[model samples]
Target chain A: MIVSLTHLDTPAALIDVPRMQRNIQRMQQRMDNLGVRLRPHIKTSKCLPTVRAQIDAGAQGVTVSTLKEAEHCFAAGIRDIFYAVAMAPGKLPQALALLREGCQLSILTDSLAGAQAIVDFGQQHDTNFDVWVEIDCDGHRSGLKEDDKALVQIARLLTRGGSSLCGVMTHAGSSYELDNQPALQALAEQERRVCVSAAQRIREAGLVCPQVSIGSTPTALSAQNLDGVTEVRAGVYVFFDLVMHNVGVCRRDELALSVLTTIIGHQPDKGWIITDAGWMAMSRDRGTQRQHRDYGYGQVCTEHGDWLEDLRFGAANQEHGIITLQNPASLDIVVRFPVGSRLRILPNHACATGAQFPHYHACEATGEVHIWSRLHGW
Target chain B: MIVSLTHLDTPAALIDVPRMQRNIQRMQQRMDNLGVRLRPHIKTSKCLPTVRAQIDAGAQGVTVSTLKEAEHCFAAGIRDIFYAVAMAPGKLPQALALLREGCQLSILTDSLAGAQAIVDFGQQHDTNFDVWVEIDCDGHRSGLKEDDKALVQIARLLTRGGSSLCGVMTHAGSSYELDNQPALQALAEQERRVCVSAAQRIREAGLVCPQVSIGSTPTALSAQNLDGVTEVRAGVYVFFDLVMHNVGVCRRDELALSVLTTIIGHQPDKGWIITDAGWMAMSRDRGTQRQHRDYGYGQVCTEHGDWLEDLRFGAANQEHGIITLQNPASLDIVVRFPVGSRLRILPNHACATGAQFPHYHACEATGEVHIWSRLHGW
Candidate 1:
């Protein structure tokens, strides 16, 4: 049943279908121009409909952060999938199940021990697995260095154990911290150079390495050239948020995801409008706190998606969001956002905020709303 | 079917059942001594099994932050429920449905506009509703000030419209900021005093107001006297977190909730152990940041629940948590927490962390694990 926005419940995740489509097109077009396959990260949405939209908009495959997402996407008929996180040994069984069920799933590993575990499991099961060597480009979080001898060591271990070395993938997650274009571009280049170099090192070592994947939203959008990179993976760009806005990747108007809430009360003395969308709805991701612009919890927007510049969601409780006006006592707080009036709050991190809900209320420009179920937990 | 903790999936919410029951018993005993009913807030653990334990431990009723929680608890055979947050007009129908179903749900409102809406809706449907007035005791988030003239007006509106003026409830949520006993005791008294004053004012206006509830984990544990208060509500105390640890409410050992994660990889140079539990598992609630001690993401613990003080979750990405050694370069990071090993991380906020997962792996001292489902979304 298609419902209108007004009829849907408050504190709901609303995806502006047009805006999401536009975001998908923008990223897909950029990847095409860069001569690389776009592996849209489904972790940002974790919804099959959203992934289908990305694939429908020219994405080559889906990237996942968890095995559950891999299972969800693979069951939904997505042939190509990459379980992006460094594979845990205990999770090998789940991955093996997915592969055995006809999923062209690729697992990642940054260390020799991890690769050895994968190879051992594969050899024991008599099934050669497709594995990707993760490279650390910006000293970000996980992955091995481009010059780390372990890269080729891991690749050799996989090949020696009858497993196929699919490629090397690196995420310049630190790109989220860069607001300037030069830094983003430099990091993007660094990400590409490192992964491509890792792939080269493996091939030079008499090992077959077929792909070089690199990206993060900022790096993907700012990369001048891909060169040897085969595919690019990026999440959060599909639903740009306050953090991405502060990072200078997308305009606030381009934010596709928002939490639809209703003003339940007002602390007029403090210029605070208490809404139903708290940290639980907006998420506790104070991602924009250290960014160029700090949106307390989120930026307050009108129900029609217009920005409310002076009003900000400064504090949040479990189910109560305290929206403070820039100029306290300047406006009639109660008169402006009276009780029962609905409002939209653009979250700090789209990925974090989207994960809070079980499903998304895809709101169309024509006032139609459709529920899209999201995959929860690992 | 009972499972073992070691066999469950990584990044799972693990509730130490014995510790939880102990926490419940402590709170229930304290409320009993204070000569008041304890209405344990179900928002912390939105699971029937958890709530059942609370009810079994002498909790008279349950307090809820969302209508969904109210419905869930009511369906689970809970009759007395206080929908604590100020009633959103859009949610009145849901509340009415619960009331019609004999849930004995009490709704709260702080504004005259909200009270009038409730009265209007009640009259329109010819159904008298039990309403509670929310009093602002500490200028924390929501509710009308105890001295505000609107308090009596709202109470009058409820009574005149044939709705039962149940009582006044106030949460000294700001008490979370207090770490010392003196301050916590004072705030507890202040919360009780103001709420009692509001109840008295309502009665002076010739209205029947019986209940007076006030609490925060810190304040509830430190309260010297209940005075005129009839019942109290506190949620996070059930599954004490790092925030409660800093609040001086519960010891680290008493923390019942934790995220069971597996070591996936390591960055030896940086002395970082990459774990599968990231902010997505621990949540982004930096609630202890401004407190006495700031646990970066959480305090790392052994699978047996022993605190690893030398290690800390210094950083987190989407699905990767970087655990850094307190004395970096001292011990061998890889040797200490090798790839595929398991660890438990106590979260900053139990409510926020528990909300991240679909179910909790209730771990027993004897190595038994029971899956307790969680209610998600509004």
Candidate 2:
């Protein structure tokens, strides 16, 4: 007795297509107003349809974190791609294939050894490759210091060795750790300074560094200036989560994706309601750790996607989540939900949880349902 | 220039088949020595070859965490299964299908509400089901208090209802938090006390408590007594990891599975080497936080499966990992590995990381490699 749309299985991934389209348009409009190219990172939503929607919304190119992602997008006829992560020599064959296929492929590296390896591979294969030096903007992850002399040396080596230098790129990953818009803005400015400084150093070394890229969803959404950045790459903004909301990047209403789950049981005495959505569905992303909010797994939502007042996923295991009502005793509502009641759970990090599933049940603005396949594995 | 094995691809998954086979046999011998039925949990490997090996090693039953796993095993001719996770009403259809197909399915539940839901569903579908009342052994996750009167009441309900009460089950999930064998033994004692106590209570109530089940790799391997217990379920021992080693369950030598990665680039001056395995290849599971072994992501290994002394993954993103040498000043070896140099990474938790991949490259005891398909989706 499966209802057509109301009663699907619990702990399933659902995408609101209209909300996704709106998210894409909103991001594109922001980039346009700031006079920067939008290269939506595909790591957020690995679905081809979502990527296509980004392209359709006026993205000049797209960014990917893996060769598998680049290959998938390139095969799908996306002409330009930035393999934003540092590329290894073993990926040379795949990178060369994308280049041979007339796709504008750009890769990143932060070390001289990496540059030399790429130079040797390019020389051996008799094919030129575009390269970007990754600069550390805020010391969050991998990158070369903007003022590091080694970077200029590596840029000189690549340029002189026939490798096409494609300028510099930096991500303010630390922006995610900021508490407010001012801190995020400061990080954004720091990101611009580092990337612009690195690019200027490369240009001063008698090389053309034309493309400067800086990105972070927080920075991209609120940064006042993109005066030096040519392109921005941010992924999480398209499907904002509770983490994003806590960080003040977007409001709760702006979230476009959630795990649709069912209320299976209730402990009326303890006011504990169990849902089918668990760590396997919502992911083990404790993204709100730095913030004041300890959203156990996620924030519970009403059937129509509104946030349920003061409800939380208090505890979760691999496949079972326990919801403890914040004020269990005071609620006047029917304490027990029926066995088949459906609810949506807003995730803490959309990318991690969404990656766990194969396909998304796309709900249209008119309430039509369609299936969108997501790419998985390496 | 794709080499048949070595240069096939960078950052690929690798299985030490001989080692895994030995691991399987070792666990089986332990179970046999204890005179307990072994129900190997398939959630760790999720590969059919590994599951087949467990069957070959004398496992009478298998434990599964998801319905997808149950479906896969049932199709593969696995007759006896313990859907170890608490059952939800939404999972009724698949559970009923498996039962109808003659697969012996026993589910675990902690509360009377959950049991009653299953009984109602079974009665409505005209199907009989088996159930195990879950007991809280160590307050690690979901379960009923050992001395709760409700346990006896639920046992009575299941006995009189259409469902058959098989016995009582408990998992010492807190055992993983232990740092030594003595601590693990203490947790095991806690596990035994709760399970034995619950079984005794049920028996005193005139219910036939035929089986007492206890699980978790640490407790399963270290338990001194199974006076009232009939079965043991442990998953991670098949692919022992850094976390397991740190927790004194198994040593590094016993680890059987690893992610095969390639050297993609290097930052010689910064002492940073980049590999293809990131959080995607390895998961974000930093198991047992008190271990103090800052396995940045995972331990680095040579192509032949030996630990690369002084090399460890220091940082990771979604698809890129940065490896740092313990001593950066030493230039005794070439500062940079060539692109395509293969490496292997030991995972922190086998179950979580293994689930991300769609298939395993099954390596046999004789060093034969074959592709094993994985089960995905709902």
Candidate 3:
């Protein structure tokens, strides 16, 4: 059944279908031009319909952060899956199960112990697991440094353990901090060079490392060349948020995801219009706090999707959002935003905000909404 | 079935049932002493078992932030409930349905327009909603200030529209900012005074306002006198978190909710033990950031629930947490927290963290885990 924006339940996760499709097309076209497979990270949406849209727009396999997502995507008929996080030792059995069920599920490892566990599990199960060595292009988070000797050590251990050393992957996650084109492009280049070098070093050590995967939403969109990279994995670009907007990757108008809420009450004297979309709906991801712009909780928009330049959702509790006006000089908030009026709030981090809801109200061009169920939990 | 913490799934939400019961007993005892009914806000834990525990421990009814919560709780045989958020015009039908289904559900309204909507909906549906006027005790979020003329106007409108003017309710949400007893006690007094005054004003205007409700976790625990207040509602006190720890309400040992995570990898040079419990499991609630102590993402504890004083979850990504050693002088993170080792992380906000999971692994004194399903979304 088709539902309009007005009919949607308050505090609903609304995916502007046209904007989402445009975002998908933009990222897919960029990857196509760079001659690299675009393994769109389904972690951002976790909704099958959203993943299907990405695949329809020329995306290759899906990149997942959790085993649950891999299983969900596999159940939705997408066989090629990559569990991107460093594989936990106990989670090996789950990964093996996915592979046994005809899923091209690739697991990641950055340490010898991780690789050895995979090796042990592979040998015990008589299954050669497809494993990728995670390389750290930037010292942002977890991964074996590209120049570290452990890269080849892990690769060798995987092969010795009867597991297939598929490739080396890296995420220049710090690219999210860069707001300029040059900085983003440089990080993208560095991410490409380092990850490719890791793949080369692994191959030089008598290991077959075929794929060199690298990306982050910012790096994927900014890279001028992929060079030796086989595939790019990026999330959040599929539903551009305030963080991506401040990172100079996408315009605010390009953001596809928003929380549809109703103005429940008002503190007229404080010039605050309270809404039902609190941190629970918008998420506590203050991703834009240190960015070029700090959208406290989110940027408020009209029910029609027009930006409310003067209004910003500054503070949020469990179930109440305190939306205050920037210029409160002459504004009578209670008169301007009467109770029961609906509003759309664009979140700071699309990934975090999208995770708050169980499903997305996919809004089409004709104002119709389709409920897209999301995969939750591990 | 009995399960040790180490044997349970990694990145799971675990509720320390014993500690929760103690927390419940403490709050219920205090409310009993104050001569007021305890309507525990089930928003903190939308799990039926958790709410059942509260009800079992002398809680009269439940306070819900969303209609979905009210519906979920009502289905579990909890008939009396307070839909705390100001009524949205569209949700009147849902409330009416719950009311028709024999739920003694109470709705809140803070504005003349909001009250009018309830009145209009009540008249249109031929249902009289037990409406409560929300008074703003502190300049925190939503509510009409206690002295505001709109309070009486809203109540009058509710009475004239064939709705029962139940009472006035206020939450001293700003009490969260107070860490000292003096400030908390004073704020608690303020919350009680303002809410009672609003109730009196409504009565002086020839309307029946029997219920005078007020609270917040801090205020509910600190209030010395109830005076004219009929009931107190508070959430988060059930499973105290790091925020409550810093609020001087609960000791670190008293925290009942902790994310059970497994150390997946290590950044030895950076003194970081990477864990599977990311912000996705612990949530991005930095509620303690502005408190007396900033516990980064969360405070680390041993698998047995003992505080790991030297460790703290400093940062988190989608599926990875960077647990750093506070004293890295002689600490070998890789050796101390070996890969695959399990740990428990007490959350900054129990309400936020618990919402991330589909169910809580309720851990009893014997280390047995019982899956308690959680209600998600509106």
Candidate 4:
């Protein structure tokens, strides 16, 4: 039984700080070479230190999924904030509060009613709000199609209703389902084209369309060229997970976020080593289930972070993780892992996993651990 | 748009207080009639107020999965807390800290090493620890099988190693898979039998085994008689979810936990009404996927808590939920839901979904909303 790091409670979220730094640098350098500014989405790591690291590495601004992220980031001195999800009308007062507090907040809309709500809110507040028209590149989730007439219509409403029609943005979120480089590159190009097309149409309609933003972690890394895209936004690259690894974007070793857990017991007859981390610690994200490799809940590794390739982390309860042999030939599971042994579990989705904890234990390569607080809810 | 609750943020965790009270009442009443102590597992809510409600309604003590939960509940004057997850040896100091602080903390161990560690720790501290031997009722997760020789061995280890062998406990978590009443009842009886048999074996070995505990929400609710069980422990009954609903344990209307979200945008042609509660808010728990009914992400309900049976919440990104018609197409999706309208999303697993937020907006049937903080992480 290893006594070192026993102080750390099992089922703790750990951030490999050096690996995270490498990931940030790699993404920033790629975006720099592509001639587009990187606005690292703060959704992946809601912790400010990671966002600050990205900002210091030349990330232009930050893209947030919730108002809580904007509030947390803004309070931490990040001025340029983009609320990436389409604006909800009821949230206008909150947005106005942020704007009044001098947050350069940009909101999104893809529908005529959505745009109208923003416009009406802006008029009601007697202030102009920065707005982006979301474009649909791959029909993944939200946004208007690239050729949708509502793009220009929404732009016109924003401009006429006293809100600034800042630009067009699209997230090729469907790129996550792709595993090949060619498919990723094609989707990246389409993502770029969609946003640029929407922006061009808006500008052609005599509205101010200054910025064109497009990305998803896969598209951002795979795009061969960024013809008209002004800024690239991507989350999850900072702490690439098993899902991203399966998508052929990041190497499995580059995964920075992992749940530090301890082997609590074992079902020796069943070749199962039970750990304290389960769906509660690793999260319920089955992001890699349909990929080339399906990491049931997460991938297991040794205390020093070496891959445990033969052991499969599978079938989790709330707090009990059942790790068993992939080949299942009856090794002494109890004697091998024993109790009190610690292991690092690479999550399927970093964002979901990180949210499971209130803070991350950032461990440096030199073995120093720092606790970084994370913003949780909206 | 209803402006009454517009002050509340979107994608918020909401607890319908009245419904929650009913759930607590239903479980407590059942346990009361079953002639066993109801040690409510606080893992579902992880909030003090809800646990206090359960206690106020006749629960004996609380069952916690993490030491953090134990610490929090203990601080709240909940003296008897069973740290139900098998004791991670490394967490012994933390658990010891709780025990030293006058908290009646009961820890569990299913393996020899686990029992040895607890015994060693107690011996080193010159104190006797309260220990529960976990029995594997069903072949789902952790614990030793009822017939396993380790049952008596571990019990003897604990009793001799300066620790009080409190009893044997088991959770028929596999009961979550059953959809019919007969299967649930069978699993419940099996769960009780396993715990009782293990305790009987330990007692036959002349060990001090005083209690027999067994449960899972489905089994706890379905058990015809508790025969030899001294106590029943179950969580997720406080806020029943779609998963429990699929298991035929709880009704759809009995679920107390729901995410309060706003319609943010739409893809009218695709018949998708987008909302702010995506996986980030509703959680990544697709617990209902393999069940009788698959609520894609969650079941959509009105702000007043009425179910929208036609709308299925499908395909979620980080911050956007796509709620669409079950029959596919034909609805004026945007007009029906609108951009500012509020809706409640019933989760697949209440425990998973409730953990997504730091606090729940506990809305009384009288329309008053109170924030109840939840304990997150280790």
Scanning candidate 4 chain B in windows of ten residues, the lowest lDDT window is B1-10
DockQ of 4: 0.86
Q: Which pairs, if any, clash in model 1?
A: none
Candidate 4: regions farther than 4 A off? A1-6, A328-330, B1-6, B327-329
Which lDDT tens digits does candidate 4 get at residues A1-378? 112344877788989899999999999999999999999998999999999999999998899988889999899899999999888888888899999999999998888988888887787779899999888888888888877877788888888888887788989989989999999999998888878888888878777899999989999999999999899899999999988998899996688998999888877767888888888888888888899899888989998788889989877888889898865565666667879888988899999999989889888877778888898878
Q: What's the true lDDT of residue B52 in model 1?
A: 96
Q: Looking at model 1 chain B, which ten-residue stretch has the lowest summed lDDT?
A: B1-10
Ranking by TM-score: 1, 3, 4, 2
> Each prediction's Cα RMSD?
1.0, 3.1, 1.3, 2.3
The number of the candidate with the highest lDDT is: 1
TM-score of 1: 0.99
Best by DockQ: 1
Complex DockQ per candidate = 0.89, 0.46, 0.82, 0.86
Reference contacts recovered by each candidate, as fractions? 0.88, 0.49, 0.75, 0.97
How big is the positional error of residue A239 in model 3, measured in Å on the Cα after superposition?
0.7
What lDDT tens digits, residue by residue, belong to model 1 across residues B1-378?
587776788989999999999999999999999999999998999999999999999999999989999999888889999999999998899999999999999999999889999999999999999999999999999998888999999999899998998999999999888888999999999999999999998889888898898888889999999999999999998999998988899987799999999999988988889999998998888888898888999989998789998887889988999998877678777887888999999999999999999999888777788998999998
Candidate 4 CA-lDDT value? 0.88
**Candidate 1: residue B362 lDDT (0-100):** 89
Kindly list the per-residue Cα lDDT of model 3 for residues A202-315, writing each as its tens digit. 888888999999989999999999999999999889999999999999997799999999999886666788899999999999999998789999889998789998887889
Cα miss at B358, model 1 (Å)? Answer: 0.2
Worst 10 residues of 3 chain A by lDDT: A1-10
State the local distance difference test value for candidate 2: 0.81
